[model samples]
Target chain A: GPKVLQIPSHQIIDMGQMVTLNCDPVSNHLYFYWYKQILGQQMEFLVNFYNGKVMEKSKLFKDQFSVERPDGSYFTLKIQPTALEDSAVYFCASSWGGASAETLYFGSGTRLTVL
Target chain B: QQQVRQSPQSLTVWEGETAILNCSYENSAFDYFPWYQQFPGEGPALLIAIRSVSDKKEDGRFTIFFNKREKKLSLHITDSQPGDSATYFCAASGQGTGSKLSFGKGAKLTVSP
Candidate 1:
């Protein structure tokens, strides 16, 4: 089974600070995604990235949120001046292709806590 | 707004019994449905998936019954074991959505031995 690794399983940051979550997707996977899930809530789509560009994003992806995979190293999600509502577990996923039928593999998730 | 809906926030079934989890979607464009199982402290793992062209898909003890017209589906696990206790999420994606998935609030199942 393929695995996606997320760094910093738990993070606690001040509400006005910046936080970055990193992801290591499967070696051969191309498309990458970020999803947010609050405790006891459904997972919500944040954004998807492909070929160094944002392919699609949901409304939950706020203006303060950004993603990048600089030099194919790690897919990172950065939230600047985070809000209290930003506290959630962020899961990273990747697929070989950005198609409806492609299977997406997910990471364990990075739990972000804003205080 | 939730594009996908799942019933029975939690379910309890005896070992060796069958457990059914129901799901419905509001979007007709959704053509691919995949079910994922998640345990505490772990990521969601793909259990089984069904395409719009198929009404049923089975793999081992897990089966997915899909109704395209009604935009509903159900995942059935037969011979349930205590190890089967986990949260199941129903996700949907459509053409041109760039493979972005809309997931339902998961149904947590507890298989008692």
Candidate 2:
């Protein structure tokens, strides 16, 4: 039962400020991902990072959103000059490698409220 | 394109009753079909999953029936309990090795006593 932990479970930021949401994934996981879910909408794929580089991303991953695992500690998602539409539940997930099998372990998620 | 679609925005069932959730998808290469359960303020946890090679996979009260030809699936919970209430999402992913989850809109299930 591996667990993914997220810091600052909730955050409120101004419309033009920067916010960094953090995640600590399972120790043995090699794959990492970020997913966003707007209120009352399905969870949408954002971006994925592994081996210190982005492997793939979806259309929803915007320029304002950037992910980094500085010092290989915390996987942080930073939003610069946040907009009203930036508000959503951002989730972090990690999984072990598989030829066609990536079983993800997700965090509780950070609820971002951009006002 | 939206690869996955689930039915019933919400559902309510009494204790000891059976709950069935349906889902459909557009991707033919998607080999893994999984169902995730989410409580009020928690993350979605993997409940049950099935591969295209299998028609059914059962674990405890949760069962996943997958039809690869139709690209459809269903989750059946037998003798449901109140603790089983949660938002259930049907997800599908292709033969990739990363976050290729094409998720459905999700279905909310509430089991009352």
For candidate 2, give the lDDT. 0.87
Put down candidate 1 lDDT per residue, B1-113, tens digits, no spaces. Answer: 78999999999999999999999999888999999999998889999999999999999999999999999999999999999999999999999656698999999999999
- Please report how far candidate 1 places residue A7 from its true position, in Å: 0.2
Q: How high is the lDDT of residue A12 in model 2?
A: 98
The candidate that wins on DockQ is 1
Model 2 per-residue lDDT tens digits across residues B4-98: 99988899999999999999998677888889898877888899889899999999999999888888899999999999989999988867535
| Residue A27 accuracy (lDDT) in model 2 | 91
Q: Which candidate is the best by TM-score?
A: 1
lDDT of 2 at B41: 78
DockQ of each: 0.77, 0.56
Candidate 1, residue B8: lDDT: 90
Clashes of 2: 0
TM-score of 1: 0.98
User: Candidate 1 at residue A27, lDDT?
Assistant: 96
Error of 2 at B92 (Å): 1.0
In model 1 chain A, the worst 10-residue window by lDDT is: A95-104
After TM-score superposition, the amount by which residue A92's alpha carbon in candidate 2 deviates from its true location, in angstroms, is 0.6
